[model samples]
Target: MSEQLAEERASARPIPGQVGGRAVMLIPRRDPGTDESMLPPDYQRIIAAVRQAAGPVMAREVGEGVGVDVSVKAKLEPLRGKLVRLVDRGWLQKLPDGRFTTRL
Candidate 1:
């Protein structure tokens, strides 16, 4: 092989997140709605529900408060994920009773 061609082939490196020779792009997870604000857009309903509640509220109530009558899991799953994110960010907390409340 030509020296230049050999060098070019040697310098070529595989991209990350690839498995089994498939191109899988891996991105760090982040809340898209939290770009410029403390609260993410996706969790606005959740926050509203918690804020409107008399006290710390259950996840079910928050899911219902999102206007979801059925498929509560659909609502709760993303809400739960966002809540975890918020908690990690120090803006919310999960109570011992599996409820949520805002820190600020």
Candidate 2:
């Protein structure tokens, strides 16, 4: 019985923000009426940080809000990737100058 249950669980569909049992770090493109709650906690924070900015923001500035180590190039790269992903997904916009802002 236990083995059956385990097998069933293993075969279940992957959860949102996951694919093939690995967590997806990037947010999906925003659907027509969807909200931030549909995003992973970290992605939600990224959106909130951009929304709260007084103007378009640099990735390093956003990193500060998301608790990343802004001074570390490696740490900032992933955050930048997430920011770019958000831009690609329509949740944020990338200014020509390379800063980011909320789409709304």
Candidate 3:
């Protein structure tokens, strides 16, 4: 049982809360390097949509706003990852319900 593995396993444990009939857990991400700049245009667009919303914005909503069909999970998955990275970078806040909002 490596320390890192233990830590990850612990994090995977479910937390208490119900949103849309699903349990929600909020986990922060490890920070990436500071020198990293320049996000893709789509990432920027997603962030902008959340900021404009001025509240929690779901991934599906972001996809819809960006003219991408959220029904296609494959196309939506990459945007979700980018959203998580943006949250880690402090440009956005990821809510426990898998929604996001811009950081003030």
Candidate 4:
């Protein structure tokens, strides 16, 4: 794997319950009728924070909502990455202005 890819994977929170002791994706794409309980606790918190927003939100706002220390830029990067992943996986929408909102 590329160095950047490895770093990105390392930064993400590990999903529980391995496949034959190998980790699997706990944050699978949100499908119709998908249960929120299927996601890891952190991912579920991100989704809940976004869903409760009155409008699209930035990564920092999401960090605050989920109790991450938003004062540190480095700390927010992982949260931002998770948000982008959700957008890619059909769990959320990234607006043209780069704010995020629920796809529903």
- Each prediction's total of clashing residue pairs, residues at least 3 apart in sequence or on different chains, is 0, 0, 0, 0
Please provide, for model 4 over 1-104, each residue's C-alpha lDDT reduced to its tens digit, 9 standing for 90 to 100.
Answer: 67776565445553566778887565666655565666677888999999988989999999999999999999999899999988898888999999999886
Once superposed on the true structure, which residue ranges of model 1 sit more than 4 Å away at CA? 1-38, 70-74
All candidates' TM-scores? 0.54, 0.76, 0.59, 0.74
Query: How far is 43's C-alpha from truth in model 4 (Å)?
Result: 0.7
Candidate 2: C-alpha RMSD to true structure equals 8.5
lDDT of 1 at 78: 66
The alpha-carbon deviation from the true structure for residue 36 of candidate 1, after best TM-score superposition, in angstroms, is 8.8
Candidate 3 lDDT, 1-104, residue by residue in tens = 67776566545532457789997444333344221124445666776777677569888888888888899999898778878877886778888888898765
Candidate 2 lDDT, 1-104, residue by residue in tens: 97787665445432457679987654556756556766777888998998888999999999998899988899999889888887888888999999999876
Q: What is the Cα-based lDDT of residue 73 in candidate 1?
A: 68
Residue 47, model 1: Cα distance from true site in angstroms? 1.2
In model 4, the runs with Cα more than 4 Å from the true position are 1-24
57 Cα displacement, candidate 3 (Å):
1.0
User: Of models 3 and 4, which has the larger lDDT?
Assistant: 4
lDDT of 2: 0.81
TM-score winner between candidates 3 and 4: 4
Ten contiguous residues minimizing lDDT sum, candidate 1: 27-36
Better of 1 and 3 by lDDT: 3
